[model samples]
Target chain A: MSSWEPDSDFVFHMPTKVLYGPGSHREIRAEMADLACDRAVIVTDRGLRENTDLPARIQKALGATCVGVFDDVEPDSRFEIVDAGAAFAAKLGADCLVSVGGGSSMDTTKAISIVMTNGGSIREHLAVHALTGPQTPHIAVPTTAGTGSEVTNVALIKDEAARTKFFVLDNQIFPRTAILDPTLTTGLPAGLTASTAMDAMTHAIEAITSICRNSMSESFAVQAIGMINGAIRRAVEAPEDILARGTLLSAATMAGAAFCNAMVGVVHAVAHALGGVCSVPHGIANSIMLPHAIHFNAVTDAEAYAPVVATLGIKASSPLAAAQMAAARLTELAASCGLQTKLSQVGVNRRQFQEIADKAMADGAVLNNCRPVAGPEEIVALLDAAF
Target chain B: MAVVFPTAEWVAEFKKQIDEKPDYKEGGKGWREGVIVLIINAKPQVGIDADFNIYLDLHEGQCREARVCSDEEVGDHPFVIRGEYDRWKLVVLDQLEPVKAMMQGKLKLTGDLPTIVRNIDGAKTLVKCATYVETVFIDE
Candidate 1:
């Protein structure tokens, strides 16, 4: 019964079969056998290779078909890598595209799943891109809670030509089910914890302010905001706090689900561009840029910001104070997590920003931002403000 | 304005306070090293010199070496929280608050992300087992 209509034409969809809570991967593997999957392509990263035993666990648990490993992934996954993974899936005759990491693996799997069924280079299907044809079943096993790729049809692939991040979003790519397991994230480092937590926060706030905002999205975003506001610091400070980690996992999953349906805006649009151009890490880029983006958008919805401030639990003597408080709090949270809240600190400069901005304006994400980005100029201005 | 605590005696006082807290000891059970906090004036909003760092170390269960940041001694902070001295102290002394400052940008931190979380978990407390002149944020 998960159905919602947008305007007069589009309808929103969420994954029907969801496996949530700790150690849910086992249950997900059980479903693979039920689906009669013989072999599956495991799309993952080099980091996961060392940190977890996902591939082996899958092989042991499901007794299903196992495609050869495709671990040629970077933190900011590239288009070429996804293209290679797709070919690998085809070579293995893999029926299902199984992802075993965060956005990097899940997004890569989505792109590859489409390319496996469609006969063309990824470049062919660029904007408003649809599979336009039948595709193999895709299953998402999210190791982290951010980017809600498991629940949405959005697949972000890095475009080398435009040097931008593009979402090949369509209903066909949504995974049949998503595995939300908190144990999967216990080993996450503090930097990743803080960075990804902020990434989820960005997703929630951006969705809350999106042009397409609605009741369902607001409900999810509000819950996400509260969970993060209460538990993120504890998760960042204590890796072993399963309760805190679980809360963050839920928060991230909720944020991901919210944005996947509602879409994201400038912060993500700009973050995606930075990832493609400079190869900056997605979570860190979001952590550093979210404040500036939020500040920039604040002027667009001053009254709306009041609810956000209340959600953040801020009380100021004045509006100016409130604004300044929001900015400072962003910096402090990032700093406490061993992150700096500035693009300047992360090696992004004015010259590079101009190029990134041009690409970001064209990115699909900006359309969802509360204040529409008019052109590269406004993008650069935001970058300047962040710096 | 000098550090709100001023007396420099507060440095030793923090060492004493840190040693006295069983929760701090339990929270930091696995944390074996120390960290230095760099409090730059940023702007001489309150008074005092423009820059200085506080060198605080957590060794096993004891708090050691609370000193002023000497000239030519920049920071190699394992974990760092940066801001105006007043705001920094407000957090350190458990006065400023957590969600309040994070939302306001009064407190900032940097260093290894993994270790940061580990330290907090080991310490089992927030504001990362102090290492500040005063306790900041309520105990979580």
Candidate 2:
């Protein structure tokens, strides 16, 4: 494990089979059939359920295969809700899960699957490798271009009582198949589209700079970054532009795959903490924190960010300068989509800074940060700068 | 006149330093848990056993108690962060980042990872407080 060598003794997990295209959503029934699953339970949010005819369309596609629709999933997946969803699935005799929405729906289905198979509360499976048992197979149909929960072996579940967010990390949790249909994301609002695409970009940038990055992860991350940089503007300007949506969808999945192996850095760390403490949305937090975390890492590991800068179309004489340019470009792109660039603008108070910094330090993302964090002062400084 | 490592005076000095740092007090304000730093391979220069533990009663931005825990008391803490003598020395000497060292498996952690993570800022502050202690290593 030399300093320069990309290869290391790493175990790469690629279990999700991706079905990508303009109309891949229709492949849901066939994928379920291939998995020997007939009774499919659709887990989604109330917003998606009312706004789109997607549920009806999916039910019609599944015909007799569709057994139930648990549309009670909240914005951030919660334990009680997921537990109820598992009960609904069990009552409906669902053989498999069809998650239809953004990260919330996908993560809800993952947690429900764990409960369905393992027969325990979401709390038992919060730590890494906590799920030694198998899970009910899940097919994720993402309706948004962010989260990348379909391919990643991680699930973010919040405890409503504690008002704190926790995660389930396991190799067995990746969806058996991911249906990446661009049509599902065409109806998303411009603000959401921008934030979501920025989320994918953050995933790529962080993965490339993660300490555990390998060649395979780097390849996926670089390609995802390029796709996102080239197409996000078009996707935001013209929501129905199929090509841009398709590219963004592909990029999100690619970033998901990349980060699953390479892990993510401080951007995700601070973002997760913000999401927990301030009630800031995940993509918005990622969007606001991306540039700050990038600049922070670039100061120490400039060479690691060279490919990231290249993907962002920034070329400079020095790696640090190039990285700075890449961060600036992201800020510009985020503003173009109507996303805010500061913490105070998003309702995070000055008093909460210390708590946010504390939570950020606790996040697993801090461990994978490309550069060593000096301590809480450095983290507070980063938060203050972002603020 | 440096305080020797693994001494009550050193622990007392470390506690004083922690109380003096505004950042630690602010960053660890939400934390209400006890942590034990267990060290193994006590150097021959220190007339201690092969293993000893430092108990830190950290709660709500204050170090309420700091003392050496007997072997029977090590498991009583809500959080226990363990490592060898060399790794502990490097961390206290500012030669290693405590969080990174734990993530890299240079230090071992037990008892509730998520809780420990939620207090990560405090943990780092604790380590920072350790480095601020002017101590003479037993090996040195």
Candidate 3:
């Protein structure tokens, strides 16, 4: 026998190191040393840095090698933030970038990392796998458990020109190390807690039911679904339950990883539209549209949703039942958390529904949904039903 | 005697409809299991105190086993629901009960989410099927 490896039919490629647990939120100097990151800059939003000494703490942990901080990242961040971040990093001669805070900050870091290496505007680097250039070491530290920003290879960058959100899907965006620390999320607002948790739940379910989902992705999605279902309620009701918060953080990161390898569906696309159009908060927008989107998708893609429903411990008979159960459960969870389910309730009108639908169709994420949803007619119908 | 064709009788008839309906049969092909439903008139707004447990299992697109049980003898199956009969009737009859209400536990839900989602259309089919054979005050 030659003791050689045989040709395989399947392979899973995941390179990020996930360090989780209580207070694993320290500076990544030790990890940076491993990744050969000597000059590092922490990318964060002003809100996170507001009257907080956390950045100093990171500097202390990282020692004298820590570069200057780029604190201009904003929620629903524009691509200019990416440019500014890269320019700042270049000025400081930073070799590594660490993101702290939620989706906005992490997305900024991913965007900056790409442009800094590729030498162009974010628009030029929009296509999937477009960045053939080498990427600098980027570590994502997600403060919230929602966007799953740390592990996803996709970065949602607001295209201010097109007036719609566009995502950059490239392997370069996936963080080298994702540090899941529940402590970092302790400062999150109650509303954000519910919204982000729901967003995480959406990611897991959408991934589980996505058209491109394979068995491995499904397994990860199921675990994430169960965890989010159990954890979101607790985190919403009682914000201090570190264990539950940690579980949600873990679920979000895992979902990001799972969906990064796979892809998300229409709910994300619709939510992104809300962001680009109305500026509804990302997580809240996703939470509002989730069940309706699930029900809509269920009519065409119920079989794909079975495992997700099963993971949530729903009792059902067929694929349609599984999808219904998931949708129904999401509604229940939403009500309990005081989250609104209707688009009308959220100040969106019928006209905007069609407008959002049009925008959603143009969204790149919607192209990856389990089934092809054509335009605003059905989406308008679904939105009306949700209302 | 065909079970007297009351609500219970309609339950059987409902099962028969699901078996006969081509769309339902096709949609429910992968569904082969039992569900126990707990119908409760918690608020009694309808002035009719109806509380009963319906044990049901669908075997190959047909509702094979069904029995209305006492509250004390709640059987083990994947589905259990507790809510006002008015809500259930509204859900079954009008088929237009607010979806958010049904999902948010305002109507009361407890069971396996996967099984429920997989059988949602089938569940709707079951409700419609039962209504077709019953003389209940259900209108289109």
Candidate 4:
């Protein structure tokens, strides 16, 4: 076992009320009433708005409280989109937001709420702990079973000007309620299902090994790891299986809660960089980098990965061996799910490695990494290996 | 003789120690953000009647200046961290982590939090430098 000591002091706070079931999303009107919000706007993407009937169903469920829908959110959430969303909601006199779809939609809604309440550009509120009070009431209805953005206090918004993604971490952005309805996630394609499930897996692993992790966060992370390990393959294979979908959704939320409090580590840092630099989808980038990050972190925090090995049902002779086996098991799992295993497969070449490394070195998530990163050279090395 | 906390001598010693530590130099490389002011709120019962503001002009892995200054003199810095005298004592004694203390509301920080968070190793190194100063707490 690792000789790491428990933190001297830590705080655990998860206030978002979660409602889960087959059609729990229909309760959004009641949630709006509870928050004392009258005019609600549905924040989503154009694809879902045009193609799926989910938005129409939500609008019907919300009844007269749904004033309008803002469906301009792009695949990678951007500052301009958040500003436009805020303008749309403000113009509609929306007192509450109901975000529908994946992480981008939820994160855009969070940024819109910030801009509406704080009365400033989204760029002004990009820093951590920037909010002084609670934002506009928000109810997050996650259509995907990954990202856990509904329950997290973080919002990853891209800056088109800088060609980089900035993290917004504030306690007030936690959605007033999170509606996890398996019916919403059952339509996800097999590829997205596998990638997002691996995203949750990465969050769980990074949370457990993060330097700031405490007993409570560790509990959540460990549970999430076990749940994702058991449900990922089944969910990917049987996309219409409600039970598997529900388990994965709940596990994603649990992982979200864990990483939000304890914070994520190197995998997230590197993945965020890749998402910004190369436009790799966040979940896919995380899927490609998770095993590499585990191996890199194991050099300094082998004992921390022992719990992960046990949770993955792998028997090992020692902590370091357990960590290595855990990394190998993750690679096998991703391959079994048909996730891309290399940066090269995702169009990231050696020429872009240095820039990604520099961004990763500056990312806030790097501070919580188990090993102290010396410089960009170390990150470049990891990129080369993963490439 | 041990240097008293919140004194000019202590700040000087901290600067000297930070400059000497190879770990801080290596960890703090490329930290060109700006000045950071640490304000220790006073407790009259502990013989501290006024808030103590320690100005640290940190740039590119070096402490260009370290001194005790008034609040009015600390103009336009990118970061300011304020906490109770007792809380800072615990931090200096290595009983509490600085980032955790900030998250828990024991310390109130004003500035770009991401910059501070991104360079946490440098912050920890600064705290380590403080510990090297043989401290005589005012209350004690």
Instruction: Give the candidate number with the greatest lDDT.
Output: 4
lDDT of 1 by residue, A63-127 (tens): 54665678877665667887788788888888887788888788888788888888576655542
What is model 1's interface RMSD?
17.9
User: What is candidate 3's lDDT per residue for A1-387, written digit by digit as tens?
Assistant: 011123412223466788897777664788888888899999988877885566566667678668889999988678888888999998899999988888988888888898788777765565444355558888878888988888777677887876777666556567899878787776677788888888888887777766546556666777888898888878877778898889989988877766765567888878888888878888888888888888888888777776777677777777787788788888888778888877777777777888787777656466557777765687677667866
Question: Interface RMSD (Å), each candidate?
Answer: 17.9, 5.0, 18.2, 3.1
TM-score of 3: 0.69
Runs in model 2 deviating more than 4 A are A1-4, B1-112, B116-140
In model 3, what lDDT does residue B125 have?
Answer: 58
Across residues A219-272, which tens digit of lDDT does each residue of candidate 4 receive?
888899989999989999998899999999999999999888877888888899
The native-contact fraction of candidate 3 is 0.00
What are the models' TM-scores?
A: 0.68, 0.77, 0.69, 0.89
What is the TM-score ranking, best to worst?
Answer: 4, 2, 3, 1
The DockQ scores of all candidates, in the order shown, are: 0.01, 0.12, 0.01, 0.30
Q: What is the TM-score (0 to 1) of candidate 2?
A: 0.77
Chain A TM-score for candidate 2 is 0.97
Model 3 scores a C-alpha lDDT of 0.71
Model 3 residue runs over 4 Å out of place are: A1-12, A51-53, B1-140
Supply candidate 4's per-residue lDDT for A321: 80
Residue pairs in clash, model 2: A362-B117
User: Lowest summed-lDDT stretch of 10 residues in model 1 chain A?
Assistant: A1-10
